[model samples]
Target: MIQRDHIHMLIQINPRQSVAKVVNLLKGGSSRVIRTEYPEIEEFLWGDSFWGDGYFVESIGNKNETVMRQYIR
Candidate 1:
């Protein structure tokens, strides 16, 4: 879901991948696309970074998938 200043995504990834790596890939890839496609965004950004320095992550394990998905939605 997309909001004014943030987005909620329910992503399922391979178990071997670290959350940090996934987050980095998502942020870096999207940042490049947004910057390249819409250079005007630079004016609203701080320095050279597009995303914030920190991210929030939660592990739902085996039982709370439905709850998490509902929360994100």
Candidate 2:
């Protein structure tokens, strides 16, 4: 999980569970934790009283130097 004010998650888990189910669970738990840390973060975590409505999932591949540097920076 990568979190700023919002978040970007890159997860690798077992194949038995459906991705949608896993995403919902993770989103719910993370949202709760974020709220605990900073109540104000709730607004960012759930813009307009909703957390992310969509997610992008992909398999990892060889690192792109440009993207890697951007992430580190």
Candidate 3:
């Protein structure tokens, strides 16, 4: 939500779900929306994929909130 290629977000998921599932949902859903909304960008995307195949995720415990917030900022 912060930039075109990167996002700064905080989300809470169910304990049963894995982080990879969340990443896939976000990337897959956004890719569809982006391609549908902006047809012109199709040519610039890599092999019909808008987002890259990899992502970075970090879990911040309550004790590490300050450290994570400062790092992200």
Candidate 4:
């Protein structure tokens, strides 16, 4: 929730799930909800997709939890 341009999140998914799968689910679900709830956003989207196709994914690995939380902030 960093305005309409981007999102900063620190989500923990199951080890069996792929990052791309989670991303697609989140984006797709959010897009559908936004479109249904907010008709005005359609003008800004200009296309069928509410979000851009591109996304950034990173592995938390052994990074410190506090450090990651602060970074997202």
Q: Which lDDT tens digits does candidate 2 get at residues 8-42?
A: 54556787878889989987886678677887765
User: In candidate 3, which residue ranges exceed 4 Å CA deviation?
Assistant: 64-73
Candidates in order have lDDT scores of: 0.88, 0.66, 0.79, 0.87
Candidate 3 lDDT over 10-54, as tens digits, reads 677887999999989988998899888999998886796778778
* Top-TM-score candidate index: 4
Model 2 lowest lDDT segment of ten: 41-50
TM-score rank, highest first? 4, 1, 3, 2
- TM-score of model 4 vs. true structure: 0.88
**Candidate 3 deviation (Cα RMSD):** 2.4
- Candidate 4, 1-73: lDDT as tens digits: 3755799899999989998999999999988898889989888766788888899988889999889999888
| List of clashing residue pairs for candidate 4 | none
Off by over 4 Å in 1: none
Spell out the clash pairs found in candidate 1. Answer: none
Candidate 1 overall lDDT versus native? 0.88
Compared with the true structure, the alpha-carbon lDDT of candidate 2 equals 0.66
Between the candidate structures 2 and 3, which one is better when assessed by lDDT? 3
